[model samples]
Target chain A: MAAIYSLYIINKSGGLIFYKDYGSKGRMDTNDSLRVASLWHSMHAISQQLSPTTGCSGIELLEADTFDLHCFQSLTGTKFFVVCEPGTQHMEALLKIIYELYTDYVLKNPFYEMEMPIRCELFDINLTQAIQKDRVALSGR
Target chain B: MQFFGGSEISPSPPTPTTAGNNAHMMYVFNRNGVCLLYREWNRPLHTLNPQQDHKLMFGLLFSLKSLTAKMDPTSAEKGNLGVPQLPGQGCSFHCFRTNTYKLSFMETPSGIKFILVTNPRTGDLRETLKYIYNLYVEYVAKNPLYTPGTPIRCELFNTALDQYVRSIA
Candidate 1:
């Protein structure tokens, strides 16, 4: 089964910084992806306000009949999320690895601007490798 | 455990317990996007006015429904985004969970949407939503004085809903 569908990274202010579709069945155009990202950002914020408790963060997981979206928001408010097949295991760990790759290859590069779209070739290579590794490991199991 | 040595990034917060007053609010929207009912049990913050809040919720559901349908992995016919989908026409989301709350949604074949916002740690609510739908059918839908597509004004329905929600929350 195709475990992962896509990955999205949104800036703190709800801008789409990075989006990649990982050979998923349904493909979204750039415009559609941007719209979805911002919509998710707004929904996340609204969830916080809708919460009746204090110190509530935004949405972490959205489970649909066909797909599941898992989100991880860093302390700095940058959001990393993955859309995967429903019941995909170890997504949280996968997201954490992706975040680490972002820090190493994207953030460490001097040319990478803050809050801008990630354009680092090294980051792309590393991310692809990490995801491929995950796929191989999962399939092996 | 300590993967990032000095970065501010940390693991997500621990999941909250399902105990206590988990139910925060609920919304009942008719087929035409009219809010048939809105109830609040434990909301602390109010960012938008009542009208705006209802609209936003409806809009979110609209976009999510289309997105999910468009992103259906098994289906080959990819429809245009933002197009309205009939209830149960495509793969739809059951619920979404944040750190604090979970939003459970169910749309009947008749197009009535039942949304329940509860604590994030709450378990599957498919059965609970169905039970609520049954309540609506009995008290609100069956009542002769209650008109369809109008805001729910039946006291019997409200009382029963409150009692049920209290039991779950």
Candidate 2:
């Protein structure tokens, strides 16, 4: 529910098209974020390749006490990551809504070319709505 | 008026054109009673009257022929955008039109060009564009079929544009 501090989208080739860190000094450096995106992209690809033939591929979840990382890989090799506080509830629904946004606003936008980072205004607006809704729900209002 | 995406406007007649370039033209059609086309860039358009509180829907629409024609000599004005159907034939174009002024489009090689038909006293490009951007976010976008360059026909978009137009009227 806390506004997403930042978001990174990694292409199949591991290039970063969109990156933003809001309201924090711990802003991820562009180079470092790119490197991390690329690394994660490779890791994500490798994980998919190593998956048992019958099931879905890639790293679906990675967690620590302070934070959690969620990766969603589309059929075309684009990966969407959501890093949030570890204990956030209803994470599945939240991620589903976020993925819907990625498809509708990001992928569908003519301005947003595939395998590139997101830059569409609609994408951010919908994302903010989804996150804000979750935050409000978490607050028990 | 600002140009964006795959639409083009034909050249206006020899008179002093609302669009700067002579090549700018409008693809006009009748719906209900008003003429419609994709709003072009960099042209003066009609403004809504304040007391009437109307909504104006405005944006860009593109065609593959226009896209290819400007880029490749072999493709100018030829239907080559690959869609089997005529994309712009009845598409609802949003323009703010008050009795005193009307907004319109001018076609160019780059994208759909905008032309304003406003009384000089009641218009400002920056403010109009800002209002458009807000409307786009609040209304056009909320609907699913409002794709860029695709003719919009949803009642919601019409209602919103009408509201804006009425407000200014």
Candidate 3:
């Protein structure tokens, strides 16, 4: 079944705080991934500037030929993005779920530092299990 | 406090007077964590002693770099996701932004770190920092009397930096 290729959560400062790759695979290096995250950050800022309205906004969806990218920004400016196949359904729901998981497991954890990359074992486990469940559900459909 | 709208700034320990000063402050640090040069204009931070503030800033950058390195998915042992990957030991990020202020950072290959504090509206300063690095090499490094790891005090370098910063501000 078609599924999410990967997920990336970038802090407001353009650092990759969290990342997870589901079954789908790729070989992008660390530096390349960092560059990609930063590029999205700059592009997000540029897009907001180029917008006709002068309100708080960001890139919610970016549809490409091979893959579909969905982005969600929290009120605090941190961004969460997911990469899935072009025809994937309800990816936004998955991004929302990730945000919720991040808030519950990462933010509430006393060990976590603000604005730093995420490094919580529970957060990682819960996120992986949740994604696995979603994949199973998608295949069962 | 966080909007990217036009920001009017005061020059040199942040003062009451409103003027243009994109390059509000500059700091230089060696690989050993020693501060080589610390310059500020209209500095808003007077409560924290200069020494304490510099130490805190350097600490912040060091910890942040370590954290970024650890979070990188492709750094090492990608096959195993359960272990803590904090020993990866490298990070590549340009700047970090807060609501009111933005801190731009540049690290030289030789391990010297240059940190610039500016308003959120300031443009990208990668080239500007490279130019400043050149100026440092020309004046400070070449001066026969100047010793390494000491505070930078080249009059020519200061004058050039002043003119350049004011132009951007």
Candidate lDDT scores, in order, read: 0.84, 0.44, 0.66
Please write out the lDDT profile of model 2 over residues A35-123, one tens digit for every residue.
Answer: 65676565454433322121324455443223445665555666666655554566656666776778788877777667656778888
Tens-digit per-residue lDDT, B97-152, candidate 3: 43234467777877788887665556667777888888788888898889888788
lDDT per residue (tens digit) for residues B38-152 in model 1: 9997776677899988988888888778767776666667677777888989889999987667899999999999999886767999999999999999999899999899999
Q: Each candidate's iRMS in angstroms?
A: 3.2, 28.2, 13.2
**Cα lDDT tens digits for candidate 1, A1-141:** 667888999999999999998777655789878887887888788766766566667778889998899988877889999988887898888898999899899889999999999999999999999999999988999
> Residue B162 of model 3: what lDDT?
77
| Deviation in Å, model 2, residue B97 alpha carbon | 58
Query: Cα lDDT of model 1 overall?
Result: 0.84
By descending TM-score, how would the candidates be arranged?
1, 3, 2
- 1 versus 2: better lDDT goes to: 1
**CAPRI category for model 2:** incorrect
Backbone clash pairs for candidate 1 read: none
- Give the higher-TM-score candidate: 1 or 3: 1
Evaluate model 1: give its TM-score. 0.88
Number of the top TM-score candidate: 1
Name the lDDT value of residue A137 in candidate 3: 81
